[model samples]
Target: MEGDGPGGTGPVHVPFGYIVASEKWRGSQLAQGMQGKIKLVFEDDLTSDFYLSNRSCILYVTEADLVAGNGYRKRLVRIRNSSNLQGIVVVEKTQMSEQYFPALQKFTVLDLGMVLLPVTSQMEASCLIVQLVQEQSKEPSKNPFLKKKRALLPLESCLLRTVQQIPGVGKVKAPLLLQKFPSIQQLSNASIPELAQVVGQAVAQQIHTFFTWSG
Candidate 1:
């Protein structure tokens, strides 16, 4: 997803975790408050107000903007159509603006498939944005909330697989052997006759030979 502009085709270039704020948004209450928490870069060509990364940006709607009309929707629509940036809307949700938020949420989240975050004031919004930028800067693996692609295998399945790796073991014999011996160390310590109680004598002898074989 390209952010700020169409030409950001490769990697996200967030050097030292800078939040690219729109020139129009510069020196605003949000920008001023964020100065102490993050690095802010002012630019004129961004479709959104703040670019968190090359692929993610934020669009801020103040209480005045919400009460004004659906004007912010046009900006949001432009961002949705122009670039594939992850748009996060930080809207003022005070008593004056709360009535408009439901409709705004529908347009941004339900319609545009963007993230909508509500803050009571510019100060709170600034704090929230700082946390977002900080979290985004960290490697994805370090964030516990993010879903992982590959879930760990269950312990029973792992143990079953380990048992089946022996010389003369299969799915059928592995579970039975594990039920009796439980661990690799315990299984290796079993005498041939003791192993034969679970698996047959031939397989038990083979198992003993596999564990004792120094080759």
Candidate 2:
């Protein structure tokens, strides 16, 4: 784990791997090429440093190895976002190690934003992360890469809006469903079981019932 410092300059010698954090895992499970030594800034005022998303790291790790209550047995291990780190990895077995401890209770886990670094023990390279974060906060990014925006569908036949026309969907659930499952054509072909997995069983049943009756 790194020290509590702004800009990089925290813990050094992050190991080759460790367990994955749940928050980092959730938002990044489907995304690819989001790994390696990219600079991480603490999103908002939460943690002091951010590294690569933990979920991305977990792709290389196994869930079974991540037992609850166990801290890094060694000093050079990478910190991750998980129930154990967040006080949620409940202990179901008593025979586990006595050293098993709960995670540091904190809000806003760090987000991994870049991937260009190899694990190193160099202090200067570690400081570079802090410098990058500090520099970023001082100047608005001029990089064209940072200025890109999400593309939206034209309003005329916007499938999202058309789905909103469904009865009982209303303002909230309609957009929620669209955001959850982006394509309307995908929604049309989605099995009730699949939709239920995205939404809840009850909501999925309602959506399937409505679409089946109407279409």
Candidate 3:
């Protein structure tokens, strides 16, 4: 959206990430200020039809909304893994971060790359939006050659390494073990019955022996 510039000499068009404002933040000062500063497209629901096609970073007004057990959170996590959209959650400074740290950790573990912004209140949120716009504007174009320079993770090796770290699970069984338990945390905590269900009697006994080995 074009608007009169600060001095009113020309139109100011600030490129912005798609802003999906929640109903709770409607009529707030932050929302009002954002209208003038960026090219905002408002939505009543955080997970709307727009986000499915638009790959813009989401602007959440509160941490609770971002972490809530809802379809919105599910879709956000799905897109983060498959797309380039950044999930930025804005929380008030007055709120304790510890309360939301677990949720943040979950996002990190899922590779969602969710960002947290702790502001004093809604007013500071506007300042953050301005800063984001300025920084985005200054970003240099990417070099096509740099794509080859980026290091790629060896998934098979990494998965084997993690599974093998568990007792009784080695190279031969690590791949099958992972098929049953996708993550190290899950493999480490699986009960004998659960392990046996996937890897059978003898292997389950070996796994149980490894985790229970007290020596």
lDDT of 1 at 203: 98
Ranking by TM-score: 1, 3, 2
| Residue range 68-120, candidate 2, lDDT tens digits | 32232221123232221111111111234222211211110111111112112
Candidate 3's residue-wise lDDT over 17-119, tens digit each?
Answer: 4344445456777777777665554444344222211233333435444344433466555534543333444454445444654454344323443444456
Q: Give candidate 2's TM-score.
A: 0.26
Clashes of each: 0, 18, 0
CA error at residue 28 for candidate 3, angstroms: 2.1
- Which prediction has more favorable lDDT, 1 or 2? 1
In order, candidate lDDTs are 0.69, 0.32, 0.48
User: Best candidate, lDDT-wise?
Assistant: 1
* Residue 27 displacement in candidate 1 (angstroms): 1.9
Q: What is the TM-score of each candidate against the true structure?
A: 0.60, 0.26, 0.42
- List the candidate 3 regions with Cα displacement exceeding 4 Å: 1-24, 44-54, 59-72, 82-84, 109-111, 139-215
Candidate 1 residue 213 C-alpha distance from true site, Å: 70
